[model samples]
Target: MNFRNPVRRALVAALGALTVLGASSLHAQEIKERNLRFAFSLAKEHPLGVGAQKFADAVAQKSGGKMKVTLFPNAVLGSDPQNLSAVRGGTLDFTSMATGLVASIDKRFMVFDLPFLFNDAKEAYAIADGPVGKGLLDDLSAHGVIGLGIWDLGFRNMTNSKRPITKAEDLQGLKIRVIASPIFIDLFTTLGANPVPMTFGEVYGALESKAIDGQDNPVAVIESAKFAEVQKYLSLTRHVYTGMPFMMSKKTWDSMSDAERNVIRAAAEEAKQEERKVTAAKEGQSVETLKKSMQVNEVSPAEVARLREKVQPVTDKFSKEVGDATFQQVSAELARLRTASK
Candidate 1:
């Protein structure tokens, strides 16, 4: 009211400063100190483990050291199914597992487990990062989890103590361990092998005890899990491209503020990219390393085509389960990518 007076001007300036300070205080309050746990079944040196650490570090940095994430590698928490339950129930905050395990919650995810679905990591990445993958992730909200993004696990290959799998017939009568998922069981069964559904944590012991003759996984996984010690053959089957869906408990997500959620989303994305890079870099190296202890061979292109034909019935059955719309959408996307690449 007394703008001409110096005293009044000083009083107005003090009020303005107080308003700004109050706003800053409220902004700071939006991000509270939080500690979270992220568990997986891989060794600490695995790309997923490295990415988890990076995610934790990024969260701490982005939250100005108000947030922290502890990593639980080597399935110390439990198997993938158990961890999935804990995350959904809010007992655990974060976890990442093969999409095949996710198929138990929603069969549409089985699309990723289809044999010979992707020609290479590039094609797989395109689909995983595209609209189709986003839709599948968004659907997870109904299941009490928040899907962050798809992290790469490279391609699945066959390994066994019995013999080198040069052709589809080689898998005949050999007992092989597979993810406890319908698609995997069907895939192996269609290939003439007796597929024994089992959890990843149980595979090594089973192989060592001769409970199962062999198992299949990415070269990175085979090498990291030290399967070379117990298994004799590694076939570069590249049958399925596995993607790890990084997820958080919906209960935990609901408890976070908008600022906190943003931090989580950004950190997850960074970790996803880092994991992919590390996985790609180690894949070739892992294959070379495994050769020293295990007989290694690549399935010929003609034989892979034959193997693909053998599994077509299995694919057709699951495509129905995954729904025509979802299957077609992915097929169209893959077609576009192939055409563009040419």
Candidate 2:
């Protein structure tokens, strides 16, 4: 009546304070602690591992050590294809793989593998951070995968036991190991190399045994995999700009609260930046390190042009499969980036 009872006023004040505290608190009971597993086929020292470790550390720190990610690098969990399948089936939480490998799951991903698609890392990042890249990631949800974002895989180069690649014709008759993908097979064959598709996990042993003549990969990968130990040459072919995408299982995603999901997404983005830095830092040193043990050569611009011309048919076939409109959209964006730089 006259004045509200002190007990009633005190109760309201206490409730208001509690509401403020709860709103600001990150540790909501709705977020259950989990031991999540993340898998990749690359070595622990590789950029993929560096970024994955960064993600795991960020998640643990942000979650107040409630949720922790255990990384299974070097295909301990399974090969890229197998890990992808496990994530889709809810047996695994997440995995990172080349978009080229994921193209097997959906041909749209092959667009990233198109030869000479990106002239440099800046152009690639612009496309990936822009609508074109995000649109591709967004496309994964329909297939039970959620792409956190794309990370740099760096430009790919060729390494082999054969002579240094001075020209496109140097690839002729060489038995090259390639990712078990249509574009890789078609690309190598068009350049006159015998393509042998194989899982990355098997590459080292195959090369060591001389079962395969050579393989192509990024500079960091060539050094990290110690291919220099068995392979005699590294050709700076820089044939493709590969992007590594972090994919999550929709089932695993559905199990997390909005808070946990936000932490994960942010952590992935941060890790992406970290991975690219590591790759860039190691790029020059990787070549130097490989040269100490293996013959390293840079293909001439003329040779690269010939190689590009040879792979055009493979890109053309996939252009239709990737849908002409999507390809045109990205191509237009790439042109804009180059024009602006000019």
Candidate 3:
């Protein structure tokens, strides 16, 4: 009898048993885990919500079922500012928030919202994924939030029911609903429109009740939120570049192990890339979708330039409030990107 055959069989049987035992241990661990909650200010069908879900899925898979993330979309917990406060207070674990809202905490964030700063998604991502973006993220850490990465919110457009905004003059006297951000209010006011600062949740009702004659948002957002049904004109202004910052509570982040932090950070970055792709595709199709039900007008390049000129004063005012050094840095970055693109 060859003893080699029996030895090999015994080794194989022991290995199989170890594998089964390890898997059973993992299963037991998963059953005793707690889920993390992610809050965002968009409907479940919106890009941010979709990205949040993707992040949750990645976290759950990467943690091997030991950690999970649940999404609270459409301001379920509160508005952007409120949710951010909750995250800071450790009442909320995570949130995907617009830079506009974050700017209220640190005015430097307004640099990202500069009008006509980023021409397209690629240019935006280039600056955002580089030094400038990292600096902004680091800035948020001082506010009790750990910024993970930047996600796309698409180019901002103008929508109105009073009249088609083909030229700058058309914006005169129209009450446009804007996010509750001073920068946005100043931008619309400088463009001759009366800006009504309101929460995102109240916009649709405001538009429907004629409390606001118009509002501005990305084409994808306008279509997804069905703003077309409440408004008549869609102006391809592309005035502002919006970005959503992925953030976690500093307390929660500090409590996590280094391995867990690394995993969550990696998942957030992957989700950001996915968000940009989804937003780009949705923006390409949204205009056509809106045209089916509403009067859609693509502002000519010359008109966009004219609009830019009209809002220059707003930028000037914001630069003073946001600090000259930061504004200059952002302007320099935009110029460099444009030159390099050409």
Q: How well is each residue in 133-212 modelled by candidate 1, as lDDT tens digits?
A: 89989999899999999998889898898889999999999999999999889999988999999888999999999999
Residue 122 shift from truth in candidate 2, angstroms: 1.0
lDDT by residue for model 3 over 120-218, one digit each (tens)?
Answer: 888778777878778888888889999998899988988988778899899999999988888998898888889998888889999999999999898
All candidates in order of lDDT, best leading? 1, 2, 3
Q: Provide TM-scores for the models.
A: 0.94, 0.94, 0.90
lDDT of 2 by residue, 34-69 (tens): 999999999989988999999999989887788899
Which scores higher on lDDT, 1 or 3?
1
C-alpha root-mean-square deviation, candidate 3? 3.6
Best of the two (1, 3) by TM-score: 1
Model 1 spans > 4 angstroms off: 1-24
lDDT of 1: 0.92
User: Candidates sorted by TM-score, descending order?
Assistant: 2, 1, 3
- Best by lDDT, which number? 1
- Model 2: residues >4 Å from true position, as ranges? 1-16, 24-27
